[model samples]
Target: MSGDTALVGCDFSSAPSKRKSIVLAFGRLVQDRVVLDRLERLPTLQQFGDWLAAPGPWIGGFDFPFGLPRELVEELGWPTDWLACIRHYCAMPRDEIRARFAAFCDARPAGQKFAHRAFDRLAGSSPSMKWVNPPVAWMLHAALPLVLEAGVDIPGLHAGDPSRVALEAYPGLLARELIGRRSYKNDDRAKHTPERLIARKDIVTALEAGTSRLGLRLKLSHAQRDALAEDASGDALDAVLCLVQAGWAAREGPPRWGLPEALDPLEGWIVSA
Candidate 1:
């Protein structure tokens, strides 16, 4: 990775539309600060894929699971290798994938309906196989194929474009570290209250102070800070959060990218988790 490379953070959507587009935060790491450059929205997956394919010397933190639970993949009799399993998983129709995952959940005990990757517990993220609520499985289904087709390098997972590094990122992990799960955003406009606004400001304050374990401060102009903290949906803020993780990875660099050295190839680890 070059020292002058761009850094990106993505807040992705499985089925994007005009109102619920995929948000991207573009920045660069300068010393210990991540300087927010601009924000862009892709209202279609085709655009997202095209953007991924663009010439890069960019490292990105994408808010989506790069792999599934080992137990789930094994029980489902899917391919074990990283790229092969992703291909197999991606080839199936969403309906079929949901059916398989639902069946897997049905067979398990009540409290343990979902099988989780170890990283899920570590990052406090939803199971990648979950088809509802957050619908992360659909996200993996929609996004990973594009990442693969773009030939972006996923450190400790896939090797392709060395300049375009992709790492799994969970914004909630960093948010929880600073705020302990205080709700900061919502898609439902009715639920966008002062409390959530305050939460966003608090997070921004913590990040500006470099209070998180990542030890990198955020540099935002007055307008940029307002844009991040004022968006009721939190999509923009989440993208910036992922950008912070991407900054951490870019700073650390190379084969590990701040990932654990012994990461399970099948269930890829999240960046900075």
Candidate 2:
């Protein structure tokens, strides 16, 4: 990994619009610390792809699942090769995909409604194939193809632009480390209250203080810090959380772009999960 690679984090929405969409945060890592410099709103995935094409020598932690559950992939008879499986998945109609997944879950017993990737259990994330609630199933359906087509390398998954390595990031992992289930932000205005703002503050304070096991602190102008906390939707903060993971992967993650050597290629691991 290059020492000067830029770091990025994104919070994705499956059906992005100006009202609720993807949020992109990017910055540079210096001296074992990260400084978030910009936040961008991509109202659509096409625009996100356009932004990704701008240029690189960057490592980004995307808040989306990169691969499906190996069990699900096998049961569905999808290709097992990382890139092949993703291409096959991205080619399906959303409705058909939903129907298939629903059928898979319906046949299983309760609590087993979803198939989990190894890293989903490890990261405490919703199953990548889950269509509702967090809707990460749709997120994967919506995002991974773009990541693959962006020509960026996704370690343990696909080979593309070596300088632009994309890693699966879960901000909840970092948030859980900081707040222990204290709710931070919500899309509903009613849910965005003082308590949530304070949780965001505490999470930011700890990041700036280098209190986490990653030992990486954040460098920010007061304005930048405030901006991260003030977004009631938590998208900005989540992006920053992913930024921390990206920084760690660049600095301390395995030589394979912060992924484990023996990682399940068809079920990419989450960075810092």
Candidate 3:
């Protein structure tokens, strides 16, 4: 493995996720080429935090909301301090949180029931504003603190530790680029049909060959390749996708892919940072 690796992809699960706590993949860039190195499955947030604090040359592309819009935070009177705000958010009971958000939405104009950041429209839907996505609310609840603790600056989102850098990413951005609305992963056993397995293989091939439009590639050992292929469901594969994004971020540098300097502190960036 490259000792001074660059990017990592995290397939983030919101709180109470049935998925693994965190799936991290490592990568490096050589002569402008992106290579995947390692993929690790962390079973808890503590383990993930420990990894972040460990000594190594790395930048991470985590799949979580790095910030809420300043407008929303101010409107709700949430704490301005990132860590304090997240702690208060995590401590709130789900019902109360939901009710408050609902009230906030209800008070908005009829045409705009849910509050949206500028990027929300580009990203399809905002998980922060939805409930069915499950523990994502909690993901936002749990993750922001770690980002703050890591001290990675997120432009408008955070004032982070200078040593550890973090960028927001979504695997969907890359996946959609490859498959274009075709379903690639399913926890449902019924949905893990042979066709999906073939799709997984093709996706893997594209990643390994560095043919995807994301301008990235994956490096995997024979064992890792077999492991991904043998899994009947695509949970592991999806995690690998997150890993690829992570690898990209690590290699591409902090808040990788040219994240804007003046992003809305509350409204987070997607893959760029």
Candidate 4:
């Protein structure tokens, strides 16, 4: 890892379209600080994959699960090897995958319907195998292949094109540190209000001042900050949150793509968890 490597934060959508889709935050870490360069939104997964495959030595914090629960994988008789397991899981049709996950949930007690990857609990993120709510199960199915196809290295999970190191990241983990229990954004137009806007401003301000627990300041143009604040979907801000973690990880220069040495391969760890 080099200090000057570009960092990317991906806020992903498995099935994206023109109205609302995936967003990326591009940045560069200089000294002890990170500069949020710009935001890129892609209308389709193909476009996102193309961007991922585009050449560069970069470190990325992508908002998606890299693996499923170990217990789930074992019980399902899936491959134990990280790359093989994900590749097999991604091969199934969406409906069959949903049925299997739903059956697993139906067999479990309420409040324990989902089998979570270790990183999910560690980062307070949605369960990787969840088929509803956030539907990360489909996300894993939809996005992992693109990452794999792009040849980006996923630390303990998958070895690919080492020039691009990708790590699991959840923006909520960083967001909660600065504004606990405060919802900063909503896709629903009816829910967008002054309070949420204020929350976004507060987050941006804390990041710019280096007062957040992440210990890295973010520099952005006034218009850039304003654009992030005004977006009701919060995708741009979420990408920046991932960028912060990526920048911190890049500065550390961990050999395993910023992941801890003891991370379980069956249930990959989240970056900055």
Candidate 5:
């Protein structure tokens, strides 16, 4: 957690989303301020795992669900063991899983399709019990094994490699603070308008000026800045946002629950697991 640790912000995708892949943004805290280091786009879960396993002094704040709600796991009788639980979760076909989850939501009263805890909205931008929104299911699928393989001890969840610490981070948590309801990114070429570019510039300026509540200061290279602006699409800029998140996580240090700790085992980890 001390030197050269990488802060990572992940832009997660919902299931069946080919657009959904883990984007790794690298950064470190210098003199209590966050600084951008590098950026990489991980196109596959396996590739992300490889990056996690790569040797380095790094702690990542990934945009993924780190835990599940205790109630859901208990009620459904799913395995409490972290790996086993995720294995079961990932094993089920997407359609079946969605159907079951939808049914569960339907059973609930209106305005409560998914159970929610107060912290969910505060941190993950989702109800604590939602399987979508932040897409905790996909987060679980992408992150669990990598942490275990890294040998981190995620207390209350399971033990794993100690070198790597993965925490749940939602970019929206930070984004909302700077630009509420303003779309800063769009993958659709048709929607890449001047308005969105202005939003991106605003975000970039705020980061450079250290205006965000996270107290992070983003440092971008000339090339990086040019790349972010030149590309009509916002993919590069989005990656920068993700990078800022990673920098914040590295500065914050490891999860209190343990390196490999489960977020909720049912509800999932929203911000920090």
Candidate 6:
């Protein structure tokens, strides 16, 4: 990892809007501290794609599944090659995707409906094939094309511009480690409460103290810390969580981006999982 390279952590929405846009935390790693530099919002997919293509000596951690489960792909008879698989999956309409995935689930027994990536259990992530709740499959649908179109390298999965790297990230993984399954955010204003606010503060304090296993402190100005804690939706804070993960990856240096060397190329691994 180059010390001077920019680092980004993104909280992505498949269909971005003014109310829930894609959020990016721009920062850099300085020794053991990941500094919070700024935040940017893209309210449309095109702008998000353009941001991905922006010339970079930068690496980013994006909140979306980069691949489907191998079992799901094989069952659907989609292309098994990573890029080919993504292109095949992306070419489908949303309804078709839902129908097909629904059928896959219907064939399985209760409690074993969604096929999962190997890393899903370790990372405590929803199955990438799941279309509701988190709708990570839809997230994959919306974001992978933009990433592919931007021609950025995806470490274990694909090679593109060497200067720009994108890695799979889940803020929940780090949040769980620090806060222990506590709900720190919600999109619904009615659900936002004092408890969630305290959870956010706890997360920020832990990150600043380098309390998590990643061993990297978060450097934030007073304003930045308040901004991260006070955002009830958690989008900004989630993006910064990813920034911390990206910073950890930068420190680890790559070819693997801190992922295991034996990762299945067709099913991407999350950073620091």
Candidate 3 structure quality by residue, lDDT tens digits, 134-194 = 4456667677766656556564456555455567777666666666677667767777777
TM-scores of the candidates in the order shown: 0.99, 0.96, 0.81, 0.97, 0.80, 0.99
Candidate 1: the clashing residue pairs are: none
Superior candidate under TM-score, 1 versus 5:
1
lDDT of 2 by residue, 20-87 (tens): 87998888888878988888889998998887776788889999889899999999999998888888
Candidate 5 vs candidate 6, TM-score winner:
6
Q: RMSD of each candidate?
A: 0.8, 1.3, 3.4, 1.2, 3.7, 0.6
Q: Rank the candidates by TM-score, best first.
A: 6, 1, 4, 2, 3, 5
lDDT of model 6 at position 91:
96
What stretches of model 6 exceed 4 Å from their correct place?
none
**Candidate 1 stretches greater than 4 Å from native:** none
Q: Which pairs in model 4 have colliding backbones? A: none
Candidate 5 lDDT by residue in tens digits, 1-273: 666555655554433233545556666778656666666666676676677677765556655566655556666788877677766776777677678777778887988677553357655456433556445665565566566676654533565555555556666666667777788776678888888788877777777888876677888787766667655555556556655665655555555522234345434454431
lDDT of 6 by residue, 1-273 (tens): 777799999999999999999999999999999998999999999999998988998989999999999999999999999999999999999999999999999999999999999999999999999999989999999999999999999999999998998999999999999999899999999999999999999999999999999999999999999999999999999999999999989888877779998899999999999
Q: Model 3's lDDT to the true fold?
A: 0.65
Off by over 4 Å in 5: 13-21, 80-84, 127-136, 146-156, 229-235, 254-268
Better of 4 and 5 by TM-score: 4
**Candidate 4 CA-lDDT value:** 0.87
TM-score of 3: 0.81
Model 3: residues with Cα > 4 Å off, grouped in runs: 1-3, 15-19, 79-87, 106-112, 150-156, 231-233, 247-257
- The models' CA-based lDDT, in order, is 0.94, 0.87, 0.65, 0.87, 0.62, 0.95
